[model samples]
Target chain A: MTRASISSPKPALVAAAAALSTICLALAPFVVREGDLRLMIEIFAVFTFAQSWNFLAGYVGLMSFGQQLFIGLGAYFVFLISGKAGINPFLLLPLSFVFCAAFAAVCAPFVFRLRDAYFAISIWVIAEVVRMFISQKDWLGSVSGLPLVATRGMDRTVVANTTFYFVAALALISVFGLYALSRSRMGLALAAVRDNEGSAAAVGINVWWTRFFGFVLGSGLAGIAGATYYMSVFHVEPGGAFDPNWMVIMLFIVIIGGVGTIEGPIIGTTIYFLFRAWFAGTGNLYLMLLGAAAVVTMLVAPKGIWGVLRSRLGFELFGTRRLGPTNHRSSP
Target chain B: MPPVLQADRLSRRFGQIVVADELSFSVDHGQCLGIIGPNGAGKTSVFNMLAGVIRAQSGHILLNGADVTTKAQHERTRLGIGRTYQVPQPFGQLTAFENVLTAASFGGGRRGQDAADHAASILDRTGLSKRSDMPAGALPLLDRKRLELARALALSPRLLLLDEIAGGLTEAEVNVLVDLIAAIKPTLAIVWIEHVTHAVSAVADNVVAINFGKKIAEGTPAAVMADAAVQEVYMGAVMDVAAVG
Candidate 1:
């Protein structure tokens, strides 16, 4: 039997790009202004959320429109624990993730019964149910919501810089985690499941288990982003926390950047931020423009910007494609 | 010594159409059972039941003495049953290597380097090694069928169920496939449902003929093909022309 070269190509390029981004983003708080730092924090939060959604919709073929369920739960979990239980806000991140994951596990069996369009709507309905329940809870301040009181005593600069660094770290972790997952054994099963569930089953992939993992992991990441965002903002409300617009924005980013590839979310989020900055004063018109852009991207480049570039230019930054000689003459 | 797969009293119907009526058969270890029928004879339904893709109204499916009637498709796969669809179903965006690797790792119970090596070998065996890096969606029909067989083989199944894999192949391509199946027959059992008579007869040890969900003839390939009942069912159906060609 002849051995094949299975190692990913361009390891150096991936490493260098990772290092450069880490260094530049790590020093942003010191070099960038406070207003810029705030924007950066928002970008990082959205990046994390978009990355999670991309993983679910792009990789696992579960197009959930109810990601707000986790975001709201994460922010609420932070509020309940830190505001009532007196835990530090920063320390509540893991608790928030656990809460969202457990919630997702409970929801999976019911939501999985619906497929394609119904599945997407069922998640939105579940999120609405959760939102209504939270709105009616008196201890959680009902519809008014609660403030993240734990950070009230911290120094302003310290809080801002720490939150900035935390968001940056979370963004990096989410990307790296998903990239690593796409290279693992479970990742291969997920790709198969995404492509064709019937064939995936023929190949011994437990479709339910693979989808459950994606749902839980995606929810947990969304929760983390929510918790971190609320921690920095110092406030949380059901309306803002569980807004359906979060799902729309995520879809836009993943679709515009390129679904199913690691670089897609990153590139999509960057372009989204640029568009947001340009239309900052346009209110709903900004959203309309984004929607139109998404439509155009889908029409012209159905695979998204990164997908077109990958095929046309052989430009792969994350090494998702298999690399080797296309001929049998070269033996490994 | 024992049969690798046994379907006892399997019966299913869709509304007024009976897909399988008291269908029963057994495939012994290393045996090749060819199921020949005209279109709509429910050959694919039988394959579906054995592979756990569909449920039979009242039947017992045993694999190596264990009752697996209620097992899900993936569980049956893990229990050593693998199947190919009548139409090839490759992971469209994934590379051919990735597609086979999924089967080797998940279905065959191999891991890491073992799965990669096994996938590479299967691709080589299927004459798909050069096209391994190409996306499965980009492959032509013949390569797609080859990928389907390669993916099934990666499962390392003791019992393989093939559904019309040779339907679209040319005679020369069918011969190549027959030779490949013949080469693998000594190691595991295969239950092939084919509209192509010559291809099935060349590889299968025994042939069973069915019409309207009921078995009409069973014996060696020659005897079954020559059975009057089998000939009558094929008279109006296109099987006569298929058999001749």
Candidate 2:
């Protein structure tokens, strides 16, 4: 609550809070049930996805509709390589990030030529192309999915706990890592570019390269989270892996939680899962309810649930506001 | 040394409307050149060309004797050319301090404590020290204008382009701005395009008048203001220029 204040908490207070959070996270796997552990892993993976997209939409001033591209590419990279090379898929998680980053770097020049919605839609088009290419490649699985080749008979609890650890690390990175990045020099550049590209250029920030860096970083984070996700299911296929619905869920979590704040995704992910638990059985109604919730949130508090909370509380949990209008709280 | 900035035979057109027509000028070190024209006379287009926001269809732009005609806008800024927009475009989400700090580090190429101190000095220099922590988007017009100037100065520019920075300020504020520019005038070259004629006349070492993108008059501020061609281009130039005070 004090973090919402203009004056950041003392360094000692910050360090203490960080230590506390680390202890709680380390203790969770020991006490949690296997089913609940799997659920928590999904929640963290989804939260990481939302956080990455939030970073893109808010700080980097990019709205990409093709985030699923990296998600599918990440899942496929681990699946195909692990099945053929017999290396543990978990061992290849870092490589998944590398593959996605390299892909984003290659696509940046072509996609960057378009601005706003066109730029966003071009990414979606690329994802579709790649999905189609993979669907036709027999070695890549065709229509049937590939199973986890190595570590198939590993202890169930061990596999679950290991996945939980990786997802937990990623979730923490999405929060603290993103906050630190936003406070860095490159963060200042990202904010300038987000607010106005013309002014950023005039100030000598290389607008293209700055945006390129953000795109690559966000894509890499999403890639790793996606790998952790599919690795748990032990199956990787084109249809579900590259599904645009993944983009929809990510967009929903970010927009409903607050597009830019790290804390927003946490609150949003909680609400999203609750809504899913209650409404998932409603078939198309579940999606419609999600759509309606988004519209209402946009209409009421365009900044999202966290935005409203921050405004009311007069403090931000993880305020790395590098772009948009700053809300002024009246001094008493 | 060669002139700090030189625009040789700059020409451009939008379809049939010529925005710049064989325009040529130079400003030596420590000089101020004022450009004045009617609302649509392409005064800003000239500044845009100089700032590399827009390229000239023909001719060359030289900074310190090197041709910079093909360079990008950010590259031009790094090479010691800094500019302000007609409408102040401060990074709204950032505090006034961060705005200038970004320019100091990126544009001025300073590092660490140097950049921080430089940013503080610029904010103080622009009379924005008290509002250093305030978000720039919430600042009033005068402060925003000052911030615009401060951000440009943070670039440690060899040449500064001022595009109507004084447009929306009050009489007192404009005078304050004039004083600030005059104090800094000895260190670098400046090309200022403004409709606030009196403000221009106060700080301009030299003046040029243009209409339809062609230079109609160029001489001492008083001499150019008194030119018949300039007077015709701006029938109100004499009365309006003298009346602002």
Candidate 3:
């Protein structure tokens, strides 16, 4: 019976889901309003950002305070390269991942020496430094910002639709990609490291490399999503692109939704978007309300909403658990 | 032939506390070395040194005659040093199968079906087959201890270090665990630090007793337990060697 579960029809379900998502992606541009499409693009990008951080904090046991560092860098990479090369911003999405990943790789050796909260703050410091550096550079539009030069003359509908498709693709990949990752050997390694470093090492896992891989992958995903977000806006500045607000949004979503479970962030992101939509008119009050929601969720459901729901409902979507064999034999 | 594992005059101290006082021992394949010591006598610390979790201040660890003192913990694990914690340290969120599977995959260097099969077999051997589906964190204390042993075996190590695996178990449970260890006793060299002396004597061919991080007795289990100095060390302890045997 347990063996049967390993060969379950999860593949068929995933294929069907992917097909439906692609179909929706194809049709949404035509059916959805321009403003709504813009909103959808931002929602997907923001969710992807939350999901990547969730992977790092929950899956890999690394809490990073400077996630905005990647966001700003990703946006900067897209705007700067597209402006100078006269290339479509959409064409440069993958490079944003490479650049952020490389930056993380270079930072890991030094940053890893500081553990837990210190490691988190070190990245934030790096983000602040990069933001200041970008703020001072005149040619890179330091203070002012740069526009998507390639998209300036393109048809408004064409640009929005294309951005939707690209951002939508990134969103789909983040979800399915995270699910697939959570089931792999590396996922088990990450879980082990997160649970206990001594046990992880005793079990022959290279704890350092496992964490480094997670950090790079999570940061790279954030970079890709950040680029997609800025591409939708058609402008990127040092302050807005590298804003600490990105960290706040991610933390609020992941914390209130669920810290570890993939489904938790999905639920959390939806709630966050709704809260924003409902409170959009209240200006700064919305941020305060978001904080209240998080505090209440913590008091009521410390594990997040999905975590509570999962315990009560026993519904599992992407958990990497393999239950024991059921006693299927008949008794006389 | 060189013993499967040999510790040569290992010494380690934490500030003013000496946890290992020039400790030296050897266990060859098919041999079991039962280490008995009072609490804070550095028994677990010795296991930690052997597993490379903690490096000794000055000593050499030889695995099959290869000096492994400078190797990283996981490197030592890959070189066939597997250990269980005094208090079971499992990947709590992972199922029992996953705890073993991770070790088989990374430590044992097995992959795919091989790792799975090995993990399953280890679970069966450790009498955790019925609980393999449950998360390690959710398991009862007895099963958690069994899971620790199962995870260590998953490494397929040449030298197995059992740290208080029999502690906090009923006599019946301890007997079952002893039976399991005895059945596989000849396949690997085992260094077991156990408070339950009878559980140690049941399978141990030889025994060493430590006091304040120094070896005070070494001989057959019966001989070491009868040692006057070992008895002296246990005078103020809650569990005495004579009562257990």
- Model 3 chain B worst lDDT window (10 residues): B236-245
Interface RMSD of each: 1.9, 7.5, 3.1
Ranking by DockQ: 1, 3, 2
Residue ranges of candidate 1 with Cα displaced over 4 Å = A323-332, B240-245
Recovered fraction of real interface contacts per model: 0.70, 0.48, 0.62
lDDT of 2 at A147: 74
Per-residue accuracy of model 1 over B103-131 as CA lDDT, tens digit each: 98898999877777888899989999889
Chain A TM per candidate, in order of listing: 0.95, 0.93, 0.94
- DockQ, every prediction: 0.65, 0.45, 0.56
Name the lDDT value of residue B31 in candidate 1. Answer: 89
Tens digit per residue, CA lDDT, model 2, A28-145: 9999888888899999999988898999999899999999999888989998898899888889998999999999999999999998999999999999999999989899888786
- The collision pairs in model 3 are A324-B133
Mind giving the per-residue lDDT tens digits that candidate 3 earns over A158-236?
Answer: 8888888888888888778887777778887999999989999999999999999999999999998899899989889
Off by over 4 Å in 3: A1-9, A327-332, B243-245
TM-score of model 3's chain A, to 2 decimals?
0.94
List, residue by residue over B140-222, the lDDT tens digit for candidate 3.
99999999899999999999999989999998999899999998888999999988888898889889999778999999998
lDDT tens readout by residue for model 1, A1-332: 74654556666776787788899988888899998899889999999999988889998999988998889999999888888888887888888889899999999999899999999999899999988988999988789988978888989899899889888988987777777788778788888999999999999999999989988988898998988888888888898899999989999999999988898888999999999989999999999999999999999999999999988986677885543234333422
